[model samples]
Target: MPTIHLRRRLVELDAQILEQKRVLLDLQQTRIAVERELRETATYPILTLPVEVTIEIFHRLPLEVGDKMGIRRNTAPISLTAVCRIWRGIALSTPTLWSTMNISFDDIPSTVIAKPGLVESFINQWLGRSGECPLSLTFSLPQLEINSLYDQVDFSIRRLRPIIRQYAHRVRYIELDFKEDTRISELELHSSPFPLLQVANVCCDFHIETRVFSNAPLLHSLHLGGEEGVIVTRFHLPWQQLTTFEGFIDNLDLFIVAPNLIDVKCYWSGRESTLGVITHSRITSFTIIRDCDILQYLTFPSLQHLDVYPLVTYDFFESFLKRSCPPLISLGADAAGQGFAQWHKALVHVAATLENIKISYVPHEVMTSLLSLEERPWLSPPWRTLNLLPNLKTLHLSPVYGPVDQFYELVRFLYARSDKLRSFQLEWFTTPFLDAWIGAGAPGAHEKADTITGHFSRLQTAGMDIYVGTPNRNYAAKTHDAADV
Candidate 1:
């Protein structure tokens, strides 16, 4: 009986083992099927399209991306040949794609031009590829190492001069950057003339003595920058089409005149005459860097915006407002905690038509004086009484030192009077007055701060925009002794 029972158990175990083997076989077959399907899908050949269709696809790509594909470099054509025979043919045939070229001779490889014939071949290939289409060229020449690269510069320029002069009428923009003084002077003398050049951006250390602008009849924009005391004097150059001009000059009296000038920006050499020339121009927008007493005498008839640093005195402030009051929309003044009486008087004058005001590095005493002047009738309605411009909408007060109560009082005064007030920006340096002011009040009180917060909150909520370090919260002392004084 025991033997028969053992035999039954052994047969059952054998049957279970056979069943396991069958299951493993089925899994292996399933995996093989999946693998075959994957290989078939992955190895499938991509459909071959017509050459015209492919070319159309390439043209549709962004110019920037095409440029990154190595089209801008002189070796790009040769590199594209390695991509594929079909790609090489397409790249070679696309003359318009190769028209825009950027040449840099600063780091030319020794292997590239070890032989004279190779160098000439490389230059001819790049210039000849453009073929009848107007080419855009960007030349970046380092002035410091021109002595070492002088031969390369001459060779490249000589090779490119024919192409540039031929396509000068079609060229739209030219950017020339020279770092070496000697090379810059040489380039200024021999620079190619562009008849249709509309934009010229030049940055060189040497003084620009060439008559390069004579050929640019349609030149509308000019940006020039270099060392101090660089005088630019040109006569008979077309300024009727010129709209924007920016440069650093010791004097503005050098130029004959820019009749169509709309925007004028200058970094003055602290000279009185330069300021005089800028003030006399009919520019709609004007910006001066430094403070000068002569600013009071100059007038911009069509001027709408003015920005200056190191605020001028109260007398000059009032004089300028009264003189150039019409068409003025925005004004920014930096006092740097120097003159309060002048700033107060200027603030009054600015309260008239100014829409935006930024006062940086103000003193605690000034804040106290401005805030405590509620008793004085003239200061009661600050903006309303003193040249209160009805059109004034935005006010930015920064770097104030005072209590929350003082700030609240100031806000109330401005909110009551400025019906068109849409924004009120505050940059707090040491106080939590902004947070408390926004947290303290009724819907109407919050509404005033909200108007400013809603419009300019995206720029900065705390003192992040302020140049003076991080802000901290401290409200233990109700009255600041230094501020009170």
Candidate 2:
């Protein structure tokens, strides 16, 4: 072997090494381009968005916590973090997305991070991300056997007190739905006051002697859902500060005490034959359902909306009207006590201001009287003299079976008020037609029924929010023409 031959071999090897390095560089550049393209196109469209855009998108998700429906574990913000590193960063950074929570203690250890011992830490972490935003919290307990509920609810409350106290000042809305008939020994709240609490809904048959929610200065709305046994006075607070009161009220003291109260949704059905009268100047809306007889003792000067469902006494109802002399905007009542004629007479007091009328159930007498009313809902003196409700906006009727044939009369009645009308709901409008449609041996019955339904549809379009069907059906799409319905 010669020295010159060895030199030639070394040069060839060096050339081969240079070519391999060039190929390696080409492969590295190709890999970089492929990775970039894959991130842009192959990744989820949502994930590929700008971080801010992704955060905004995540905020729109309906994140309901402590749901037995599995929405939390599947679609919660936590789940977003589990998707990938990019989403995890995005979700963790968004504070408003974790500010609101609707928690139920029904399915224990299946909500949030979903373990027996982790819920507390999970909740702390969930809310910790909310930053300085106000919190909206709802804590509910499922119905269970008394023995079983005691230990479970006790444990939950023990765990919850500290968390609630931590965010008490930040609470804007808080609803505590405890198990039925839980004798709660009110804990000594040696913690911060709820200065930002605007709404507090406490639904429990409490046996506590101490007053709750007394420290909340900004509370405006309070819903106390206690049964007959739970005395209303037990959980007393600044009643005068509340503008809206719903659910239970044992006596008429609410009207007497709550001077600032504007909206009163009373579920009182006390059958006391007599009670003293009380006046509330600020009550604008009053809706009561199920056998109510409390109207006799109350009067409102500035009443705008009144909804009552009862076989009301004519004397009391008329007395209520004469005493209040309110500028009523809406009225929901049944033709009871002295029947339709008397009901109409009572309505004369506020007919000038009444725009919305809801009749509970129409019989032959009620239907006939309703048909007789001259086209208007107000007192238009030059327009034919007898105007019971001249400027009518909405008319809701739940007709009985016998008055099914009176649909045409209803049509005529609504046709006059169509100018100012917004809504006209006729529930069970197909009840009478069902017999005919189901073959009462009548020829062309089904076609006739179809035509009737079609007519109702056409009539619905005439009004801004007209619907003729059962309670659960959507007969018409509501147009915000007149007022909120």
Candidate 3:
């Protein structure tokens, strides 16, 4: 029995030895893992790349993203540490990456100046990183906040004075979104600091004081939006390189001269002021939206396209065509409810070089005016007539209260007279008229239907197209009676 007990004890000893061997293997594996991690952490590359490559990669990122990544103009140091230790060190060492600052104060509450010092520190870090490179600052202030700040908004404005003065020569673009009165008063005062600014887009409710633009020699494009009472007293825009100008002025009388202006869009919502003084012959395109009657005296000698939505008398049309006598290539006008006599009076002096014409609201009385021109003996031959546009390729008519026959007659006249007629589009047809036209012929009566089909087919053969469709009926009744069906 004693010999049997000794054998059992030896088996237990073997199990203990195996357990210790397993623990030693685990310790050796853990030591190797720790050593490898230590080596990798020590060898990580931080800012080892050339500065040029870093700058190029930085430029590929958007300004907003860069700003969020800790790159800011003059004041805020970019925080690259959040990404990885290596990246953080590289971003901190590079100053040029942090030169451009985009200050968006739209959501910042004006009442809370609690973090002004922190905000100022961030701005300074970005400037310090930027070094001497020109700073691009974009300030977007929402209308609600601007209104809330009112006279008190200038306190926040004063915070930017130091940065503005330091980078006055380095600032390239200054976009101020006033949208309210708080920033309006400061615009004039801040103009003198941005000497290197080239482009400005101001959306304010106040007229820019004339003295504000007196020193802007490099300003090329200006977009001004304000109330109708804001008058532009500054006549001489100093930007010799200016090409595009757009704004809604209170009065056309304030604008007398623009020497190098090429494109001008003016929206006059008030009473039409005299535009005789605007004689910019270099203007190629002009859009006027107003309820004025003084269009005749204004001249656009080099104008190619003219779009006017006048709520005044149709006489403005005849007067402008007589005075300017431009070879207009495209013309769009709405003379709805007016007789054909008025249309003829307005278009009689129009140039024959017109290639496209769109006239809406052709009343029944104007039917005779179109037919009377066909009977004139002194008028040139149908195709060669001065009043009929030979180069006209497309004609669109939107009749208000006229018969289908009037449209048919006009189409026939244009097809017979104009050699370059290409397409005719008829829109907003009444449902009753469309039903009658579509239901004219009896079932299986193809010959009688041919009359309607022939009109469309002929248009196709002559390289002309016609469309007959009704406007969308969104609010109409869905259920229909047997009679309607």
Task: Please give the distance, in angstroms, between residue 196's alpha carbon in candidate 2 and its true position after superposition.
Answer: 0.6
Best candidate (score: TM-score) = 2
- Regions of model 3 farther than 4 Å from truth: 1-106, 109-114, 117-138, 145-155, 160-174, 183-198, 205-210, 213-215, 234-241, 253-255, 269-278, 294-297, 334-341, 358-387, 394-426, 429-485
What are the Cα lDDT values of the candidates? 0.54, 0.67, 0.55
Which residue pairs come into collision in candidate 1? 143-179, 143-180, 352-387, 424-452
lDDT of 2 by residue, 338-429 (tens): 43445766777887888888887666666665665553436433233226566678877776435456555555455455567778777664
Looking at candidate 1, the ten consecutive residues that score lowest on lDDT are 476-485
How would you order the candidates by TM-score, starting with the best? 2, 1, 3
> Which 10 consecutive positions of candidate 2 have the poorest summed lDDT?
434-443
Name the lDDT value of residue 482 in candidate 2. 20
Q: How good is model 2 by TM-score? A: 0.75
TM-score of each: 0.60, 0.75, 0.58
Cα deviation of 1 in candidate 2 (Å)?
30
Task: Name the Cα RMSD for model 3.
Answer: 9.9
